[model samples]
Structure formats: C-alpha cells, structure tokens
Target chain A: MEFLNQNSLYIVLIITVICWFGIFGYLLSLDKKIKKLEEKINKE
Target chain B: MVFKIILGIGLTLVIIAGIALPMVSNPSSFFELPVVPGLEDKARIIFFHVPTAWVCVIAFITSLIYGIQYLRTKEILYDIKSVTAAGLGFLFCILATVTGAIWSKFTWGAFWNWDPRQTSIFVLLLIYGAYFALRSSIEVEEKRASLSAVYSIIAGLTVPFFIFIIPRIVSSLHPDPIINPQGKIHMNPTMLVIFLSSLTGFTAVYYWMFNLRVRFSKLLYQQQMKEQE
Candidate 1:
C-alpha cells in the first residue's frame, strides 16, 4: 500500500509520456504523408 | 518545417518540466503547496485535462472565424479550413471528455456524475456531431460549404455558453481548477509553472495537427482542380 501510494504519480508520469509520444508519433506519420503528397503534386 | 521542429523541442521540454520536476518536488509537500484533499497524487491529471479542454475551445473558435470568412468571400479554402478546424475541435472535445471522465472516476468515485460540467460538454459533442452530419449530408460543393459554414457559426455561439457559462453558474462537485471565487488561481508556483508549460505545449500540438489537416485538404482540392482541367 505504501509502495502503491508513493509510485502513483510515477505511474501517471509514465502514462502521460506514452500519450504525448503516441500523439506526436501519429503527427509525424501524417507529416510524412503530407510530404509525399506535396512531392507528387510537384512532380505533376 | 521550422515550426514543427520548434514545437517538438518545446513539447519535450514541457514533458520534462511537468513530470520530472513535479516528481522531484518534495514528496511530502512541494514548496509548502497544500495537497488537495481527495485528489492527492491523481491531481496531476489537471495538466492533461485542462489543456485538452482549452484547445478544444480554441479549435471551435478557429472554425467560427474561418466559417465567417467563408461566408464573406465564398473561398473554398476558407471553407476547408473551417471544416478542418471543426473536425479537430470535435476530436479534442472527445479527448477532453474522456480524460475528464477518467479523472472523475478516480476522484469522484464514479465514471460520470451528470454534473453540469459533464453535461455541458455532452451537449457540445452533440452540437459538433450535428455540424459534421450537416456537412456530409450535402453533396454539392457550394451548398455544403455555405450550409456548414452557417451551421458552424451557429454552433460556435453555444460553445462559450456551454464551456464557460453553464459550468460556473450551476453547482457541481467538479472544482474550478483554473480560477477561484476570488478570481485568482490558488496553486503552488511550481505546479503553476508545469501547468502553464503543458498548456502551451498542448496548444502547439493542436496547431501542428490543425496545420497538417489544412495543408492536406488544400492539396486534395488542388489535385481535384488539376484533374478537372
């Protein structure tokens, strides 16, 4: 119980990091797609 | 491109400041900051919950502005921006609601309480849903853009009422985290710093996503024009 109490915020921190990176990763992939589309349009 | 790189660096700094610094804060009571009753450690959710809710409103307001621009100029680009902003607003609205519900579950002992805050956000989701439905139901480009712009404008009017007015005027278990009755934030300095950093970081995230959607949609519109020519 003591361990759980102390580590609760740590767990929250880990989860927050995961959520941040997850969203950032999605945005990165979308950026790649947008770049590809930009390239395609330029070629045309 | 530089904007994206800058935003990424800023967000990394935000995560470090928010999580790392807070964790290292004197566990007993960081800088004499009173531990919120019943919230304890779970209170950290404030960083996530508030920012998501704030960005949701920002996106809706952006949609409203672009919607008005579309009506004035009849530019398809403005209409595209308006819809993209609304789409992103809806996404963030759902995120805020879900995160708030989870926080409520841990703090309030129920996943939902039908409290004024929760109810207002529910109404907001419904309004956004209707806007999307209104957009899709029309097949004609001019009709769709004009009609949805009108719908977005009308819907935007209710956003302030639901998000700001309703929650405050009615009684609820949800504490006013941002401001107090005295109109001042009652927060520790370190906590406030972290919260503000997270707020800026999340706002940047919203802009990054919103910019990507607008650019992508613009590309699609140009492609269609080319094909037609």
Candidate 2:
C-alpha cells in the first residue's frame, strides 16, 4: 500500500494491464465461439 | 498455436516493459530509458498510441490490396476480405485518435488544438466513415462491392498523403515523426528496442483480430446463402 501510494503510475499501469487481459480473454472466448459456430454450420 | 502463445506472452512483456521501465536523464544502463526532454514519463504513450496509428495504416493498405483483387477477380471472398480490413482500419483509427487526444491534453494542455497531425487524421476518419456509409446504402451485393472497392482504392491513395505528407508540410506542435525528415531515429537504444517490440506486438494483435473477423464474416455469408437457397 505504501509503495503504491508513492508510485501511483504503477497503479494506473496495473489497471491498464488488467483491462488488456480482460479484453484479450474476451477475444479468445469470442474466437472459440466463432470456431464452434463454423463447425456447426458446416455439419448442418 | 505456437504463434498465438508467442503473441500473448510477447505483448504482455511489452506492456510491462513499456510501462514499468525507469526513465532517466542519462541512461547509463540498458534498462533505463533516456528521458525525452518534454515528454518525461508521458513519453511512454509512444508504445501504445503510435502502434494504433501504424496498425490503422497497415489495415487501410491491406483493404486497398483486397479491393483491387476483388475488382480484378470479381470474387465475393475478396470483397468480404476488403470490407473486413476496412472495418478493422476504422476501429484502429478511432483508437489512435482517442489515444492521441488524451496524450495531447496532457502535453499540449488541450484535448484538441487542431494541430496539423490531428487535422489530417480527422479528415481520414471522415473519409473512411463515408466508405462505410456508402457500403451500407447499396442493397445490391455486386454493385456495393465494386463501388466500395473503387472508393477504398481512392481513399487509400489519400492515406499516404494525410498520414505522412501533410503533417510535414505545415509546422505544428506535434513532435517529429519516428521517421523524420532527417531519416534517423532519435531515441535511445533501450527506448528504441521497446518501441520496436511494441510495434511488432500490436501488429500481431491486429493480424489475429483480422483473421477472426474474416472467418466470422465468411461464416455469416455462407449462412445467408443457405437461407436464400
């Protein structure tokens, strides 16, 4: 807590990193869903 | 599979290094970034912001290529690819503009001052906005594809002029571009490495997104055809 208070930019960086990971994870899931849909359509 | 893993890990490392690296006036070691006189810690925006613009340019050029290919081959797949690329370009263009605006607020003391660089990108946004508008207004598939292809080619021709030439012609508050008139990078070696790495990582991310979009678009087109049949 003390270190974070002293170095506030790191806090922003941490938040940004978390947000990026969240977005990346969302994209990964979306890609998997698209792939599954493609397979289903092909099978039909 | 390997490329995806590499891209994920590589971008994570880039973000860490770009944000966490210490900036010093005199960078005596490899890890320390030389402080750009006016930018200071704010200089870090280069890693993320510039890449968005670079990706935007790359996406636009790709759209242009596929547009030309569509015109030559008259294939629906090429049209799909062309439009997908343009959509991605527009998205990144917006990212670039927003990121630039935020950075400008800190550096230039305003969100927008109508700097030459800002003006040019605004014009580009309008041009591509019209491209999408033209695309959606046409109901006929073939007509929409060919007309948009021609429009994309013309819009792409203007890209180089707007992104590269106009900014240089008029003096502005914006910093000299990475590839300046002197044709030399002014960054310290450590900064350059991270900057180049960030560029590569962002480009890979763009490619991944482009692939996913094109695949999804193709699937949608197939479904539409089946429904019509």
DockQ of each: 0.57, 0.65
Clashes per candidate, residues 3 or more apart or on different chains: 0, 0
Fnat values, one per model, are 0.43, 0.39
The runs of at least 3 residues in candidate 1 whose Cα sits more than 4 Å from the true structure, single-residue gaps closed, are A1-6, B20-34, B182-185
- Cα lDDT tens digits, model 2, B1-229, are 6787787788888888889989887889999887777778888888899899999999999999999999999999999999999999999999999999999999999999999999999999999999999999999999999999999999999999998899989987777647564532268888788889889988988898999999999999998998999
Summarize candidate 1's per-residue lDDT along B139-181 as a digit string, tens digits.
9999999999999999999999999998889986777766555
> Candidate 2 chain B — worst ten consecutive residues by lDDT sum?
B177-186
User: Which residue pairs of candidate 1 clash?
Assistant: none
Model 2 B-chain TM: 0.96
